[model samples]
Target: MVTKSSSGEPSSPLSHTDVASGTTGEVVDTTTAPPAQGTAGAEVQQTPLNIAELNAPDGNAPVEINDDDDSFDGDSAIGSDVGSDTTSLTSSVLHYKYENGRTYHAFREGQYIMPNDDKEQDRLDLVHHVWRLILRGELHRAPISKTVQRVLDIGTGTGIWAMEFADEFRSTTVIANDLSPIQPTWVPPNLQFETDDAEDEWLYTQPFDYIHIRNMGASIADWPKLVTRSLENLQPGGWIEIQEHAIEMHSEDGEVPRNTVQWLSEMEGAARTFGKDMNVAKNLGGYLRDAGFEDVHVDKYKIPLGAWARDKRMKEIGRFQQAYRATGLPHII
Candidate 1:
């Protein structure tokens, strides 16, 4: 975990490794104090990240993520509209639209092309588990000390990450926002869900120590504005981390799968029709830098499509990825 002192200058680089990927270290920087209101953002200079072997062959058994742990003690709060001031929202918020035997959110209808039905929700949760396995049970890659305060989770579908984070960090207050109120009501006390949109102006009264965004590719319409809002609402020395997949798939031998390529091409074209970018991962670093983040870092991970990796961990991730893709494609289309 690399750090920056209160002077806004980077401190000595430190080594922090992830148990799953065995990443060499994380490159991070923080401004211990918030920038002055009238001050311009710092120059965008991103530090190079030191990455480790991502898909090396290993003999160890695959790490198992327990799905049972995600089960709540009470009855499942499925389809419940529980969020910040739920009563204030109009009935249209719950007036979902159905088409071609699938359900979509009514609050921001057609803004997001994906369905919010039970199957898609399950797939979302499955992908979340894969992410946990990818990071070896770690919630985020940012290097933050124990003195952290508030946290924000953007596009918190299913609210899985936010709930787990609130459970782990009981002291810190957590706020998660999403277009659909599909999050479960049986959640940690420290966490709250909000029915909000990321592309719109943020109206939070306080700054956050950390902000996390994941799997929002093809959903966000304006990346720069989102990053800028996040920057403005962050405390000095705070961190914002985005975890996304580069949409395009490739093979190690430089051979592309014909069918997969065709599918992704169509998906990309359709997303463009909606005025959204299907492939936003590769451009996130540039957006962050342009938003005035002084020290940005990029962590790249190679996720296999099937259980063909020689390493047990990679094989597990591939298997789950394959399942989610298979089940999710129809809903997304």
Candidate 2:
């Protein structure tokens, strides 16, 4: 029952929720009785899809991109070794300075790009596409209830998904929490953004019906703990969706280039040195199951590092990788 968007990208099959314009935002309490559990479905759908086209404005110029560099221009490569050499990285102090006096180990150049930037928008679109795809799986299903309406969007960069979900589901209240407040204050009635870390204890009193987490490969130090927290905060029969990418280079049917593998290995090693797990995708399903989630399922998709891949599906994934690499690598490396 998944529907394809205008660009032909497949979306979750959730019944189209009404998007009412004006209403006072209210949070829902989930301590009461929960909804009935539902059966999972197994379906494979292939719809014409283009991530770039979905984000492009009518006929705007293709997104401008460049390798990580140190100009103020947005078209700079990320994760490039612009500031320090690889040899010095082990000894050099790595930290990021955000506007709100928050700092963390700055692993790559992508860390510097704020959620409001064009590059961030591009990444967000891809993330949304992948998330919708994940939600299509049999393991996750949202509970439908007018009275039980609450959503928690973890690592909600730019708050785009939160805004879209609020606009789509006017009755549901969404708390879009992130490390920064890049989201606009003026937003959909039911959507609100807050600056918070997922690792810390959350203060929300209500268990949510839907908890969505994305792209925590760099910031999250403990996958099992995080998944447990997400489960603890969910109402019985509620759904949780996690979206992430593998940092280790992987190829299907012998399409990946050797240099790409080497590059990814180096990057993975760098992240490991800094106490971050680059292969979070591998253990996500197990983490969920260990956290007491039933019917746990995992689907793996390979993304090409370059256009050298032969499979059409792999090529499309490569396009996304190239786009992110072209704009985000400097910050990550």
Candidate 3:
């Protein structure tokens, strides 16, 4: 299993592990995704159902957007500038530096492969909404009791989840980790942000009681290894919930058109070029199993595009998710 290196070259074979992802063996094209979205249901979810409602809440009314590629649905646009002591990104006093008002990390150079700017923030916000919708406004699928303390938020983009969880679980100390210091400085006392790579060897003084990783989408290079790391870093009988999405949009009616499929395929290929797999969400359960996780639960949902969903709740989520994709597309491309 050869993966792309930082320099855009294919590296040596990876360890032979059972990769049980639902990739469909679809051959992806090399062409860049178009600036305009196609009408196919596969890539057809590029228009915002209600951008005015979302963008209007803030001072920015009727947001200006462009059609790019994919988003975190968000990068993990994974770039950098840095703090002098904390982020050890290439020992440049800062792991990341800003280019064109967008932050990119220096350590892995192109490791993140996205821009950390306002557009990305919008995507991140959208991704959070999508997850919250999926989780039914709750945090985790794990049957975690209130007694669980010492939480870890891996790939904690924007630290939204961590801060929320910390506020809810006051007894728990939430440690958020990511490659960039993009988290807010004014965080809850229990919540702290760390600018580091979760894919690297984890060195923590204590094991966490609960771990949450979400919307990391291709940010992590080794999925199974991260599962193992989570298992090791977690306390006995601790819970870890990994919530993400499958890149291959599914439709039971076979309505997704060929052009959209090709566009989505092309997007996946671009991510793979960065050594990350956008389709890894479906295989996370298998990875947890490979890591010897017992009582692992796998839940899959078919989130609809646009307002075509039958259920009211799903329709609302689709509306948000649709707008999110629209806001995110330009940044990913």
Q: What tens digits encode model 1's per-residue C-alpha lDDT throughout 1-333? A: 111111121121110100111111111111112222332344432222223412222312232333232211112212323332244567888777898988888887888988887777877888787778777777777765455679999999889899989988989999999998778777899999888888888899987878898888788988888888888988655778888777664434323334444656777888888889877777888888877775566666555544445567765665666565556766664
Winning model by lDDT: 1
Which scores better on lDDT, 2 or 3? Answer: 3
Arrange candidates by TM-score, descending: 1, 3, 2
Candidate 3, residue 87: CA error in Å?
A: 11
- TM, every model: 0.75, 0.60, 0.70
Badly placed stretches (over 4 Å) of model 1 are 1-89
Question: Mind giving the per-residue lDDT tens digits that candidate 3 earns over 1-333?
Answer: 111111121121110000101111111111001112221113322222232321212111121111231111211322323212443334652546687667676655678877665557556766676667755787665656676778898888767788889888888888998776667777789888887788888999887767888877778788878887887776666667776666654333323334444666787898888889887766776777777665555555445444334456755554565556556655565
Best by TM-score: 1
- Check candidate 1 and list the clashing pairs: 31-237
Which runs of model 3 end up more than 4 angstroms from their true locations? 1-101
Residue 190 Cα positional deviation in candidate 3, in Å, after optimal superposition: 0.8
Return the number of clashes found in candidate 1. 1
Q: How many backbone overlaps does candidate 3 show?
A: 13
CA shift of 326, model 2, Å: 1.6
